[model samples]
Target: MATLEIKDLHVSVVSEDAPKEILKGVDLTIKAGETHAIMGPNGSGKSTLSYAIAGHPKYTITSGTVTLDGEDVLEMSVDERARAGLFLAMQYPVEVPGVSMSNFLRTAATAVRGEAPNLRHWVKEVKGAMADLDIDPAFAERSVNEGFSGGEKKRHEILQLGLLQPKIAILDETDSGLDVDALRVVSEGVNRYKASGEVGVMLITHYTRILKYIQPDFVHVFANGRIVESGGRELADVLESEGYVKYTGSKEAAALS
Candidate 1:
């Protein structure tokens, strides 16, 4: 099984005077066929952590390392990281007014696979993936993410995940705007991708709804730029029942008691 290891990672954003630190001494490991959930409130650096690992230019890795399958991820470019079997479905998918979804996904697949996907095979595969995600095949002809609803955008991300077939997928707040039906479709797409036994998932979100379908092996709580607590799937349930205020252990919460 492939492994993704984040060892003592410290991250910050680029700025003139001084870099703004986001991730602080974070460490975690995920392996093939496993699922991990990172739960946190807004501004807790959960998305920043994913962006840094995926080599996004906006997030600078000040220290530590991100290695995937024993390869140094920090040394690779964003595209190189994707080619090396790492994928990040953005929290807010960008709109490309000129590019059709079909073209964009095909180009990404070709790049990640290092060769052109067989025409007939790729078409069949894409069709199946689209159908599974409940995405209208007609939408593929439209410009990528142009005028797409929140649910549609999330499903499109999953479609890319299926077509690219990466070893690890980092989903950043994918459930944010999804309704019940949309959430089910997104979850099914993830499950289908997981069936291959080659994909490890790191689902980053603030809500617990998606956890019911993904069934994470490990659930971590991120706050103050660090993972303060972690446990098995039941941890997610605990958070669902009690909410973040209780588990976050804020000084305000302590003082109120």
Candidate 2:
């Protein structure tokens, strides 16, 4: 139903001193009901793409355009992007020390939906979502991601994904630092969201382990600030068997090859 189009996007950031470009004329498109996985090496600009799309101030788009359903995305503020149906599951979810989970969720849903969710129904929804995510009832009383473990933080991110139900979900390293059990649980939550057939997913990850749980319709290989290759699920399997040596000529990968 919705289409996210990226046309020749170029992004830059301040690294210590001068401005350094991270994304180089990146062009991609994702429609509702499609899942795209972006895989790449450490410094290959994977996170940069997500941040730029999410309208983070750190990454500046010096060229090109991003549109959601043919509407300009770059012109909107970060919060406006969310209301425009964009969701980003960050690699490192920050801690909001004073905000309780329930209030935070309610406030966010209120803003994104343009009106406050009814108290009674919202409570039921939050409880149901938490139960499905295996979160304790008492957990909602705690501050958001405050002192939570790495796996807990990741689960919390997936929890938001299930609740907010954005059009385009950009998950950056959702599998990082998760145990086998945690990975499966989070992946299932993502699967449930994608199953709706109305959400376009842009999942960015380094390993293929999560792919086994959440299948991607398309896999894109990012290298040196650009997409080097794009293919089907078989591309990820290929990467698992043969590392990124083909796209990246790093000594570490060559030794493995």
Candidate 3:
């Protein structure tokens, strides 16, 4: 089974001409067939963890070891990570103004698969995945997220997840900006992808609503840039009722209480 491991990860990004540390000694392990939910307050480094793992140029890994199936991940390029079965669904999906979704998906698939998918079969594959996600067929020809609504962009992210079939998926705030129906559709899509039980999922979000659709094997609480608590599904229920006040210990969190 594939495994992604992070040990004592420390990450920083330049802010105001200074490198501000975000992820402080984050250690986690994700093996195939497990779903781990990372819940945290804003600015607690949830997205930073995703970005750092995906090798986003902005965040600097000060010290840590990230390995995929025991191979060093920190040494790989962004595209290399994807080919190595690491996938990240960004909190804010970016728009590719001139690239058609169909072409982009196929190109990405080719890159990851190390060969071009059969065109006839590839069309059927994308169509089926899009249909499962309730995405309109018209979207396949549109510029990637150019004029898509927030929910549409999110569905496209899941579309990529299904087509790429990565070993480990890091979804950062995928539930954000989704409506009730959109959330269900997106969650169902994720559930379908993980049904094979061969993919490890790291789902990051602040709310427990998404958990209602996609059940997690483990629930971890993020605070002050690291995991503070972890438990079974019931942990999500606790976070739902109590909020993050206990974990964050911030006036803002207390006010929400």
Candidate 4:
């Protein structure tokens, strides 16, 4: 089974004066078929953890190791990470002004799969996935995220997840901007992927609303750049009711003990 292991991860973002450490000695492990939800207040380095695992250049790993099934993920390039079965669905998906959804999906699938899919079957697969997500067939002709609503963009992210089918999928706030209906649709898409029993999901978010739909197997409370508390789905309930009052300030103090 595939396992993503992170040990003492420290990440920094270059600021105006110096590199600001965002993640401090964060350690996490995700296994196949497991869904881990990382919840924390804003600026607590939740997104930073996702980006660091995806090996975003902007965030430097100052210490610790990240490995996927024993292979050093920190040494791999961004595209390499994808090929090695890691995927990141950004909080804000970017726009590709001229790339059609059909073309983009096909190209991405080709790269990840190491060969172009059979044209006849590929079209059917795309059509089925889009329909399942309640995405209109017309979207196939539209440019990726170009002039689309936020909910539409998030749906498109799940569209990619369905097509790519990575071993570990890191979704950074996939629920943001979605209404009740859209959230349900997108959560279903994710649940579909999880049903495969071979994909692990790391869903990072601030609110527990999405949790009602996604139902993470494990809930991690991230604060001060580390996971301070972890438990079953009940942890989310506690956070919703109690808030992060215990972990809001003094990140250093919170993580140390």
Among the numbered candidates, top TM-score falls to 3
Give the candidate number with the greatest lDDT.
Answer: 3
The 0-to-1 C-alpha lDDT of every candidate, in the order given, reads 0.89, 0.91, 0.93, 0.92
lDDT of 2 at 245: 79
lDDT of 2 at 111: 91
What are the clashing pairs of model 4? none
In candidate 4, which residue ranges exceed 4 Å CA deviation?
249-257
CA shift at 123, candidate 3, in angstroms? Answer: 0.7
After superposition, the stretches of candidate 2 with alpha carbons farther than 4 Å from their true spots are 250-257
lDDT for each residue of candidate 3 in 157-176, tens digit (9 for 90 to 100):
99999999999999999999
lDDT at position 25, candidate 1: 89
lDDT of 1 by residue, 164-241 (tens): 889999999999989999998899888988997677999999999998888899999987687889999999888888
Give lDDT tens digits, candidate 2, residues 92-132.
99999989988899889999889998899999998988887
Where is the poorest 10-residue window by lDDT in model 1?
Answer: 248-257
- TM-scores vs. true structure, each candidate: 0.94, 0.96, 0.96, 0.96
TM-score of candidate 2 on Cα atoms, chains taken together: 0.96
TM-score of 1: 0.94
Better of 1 and 3 by lDDT: 3
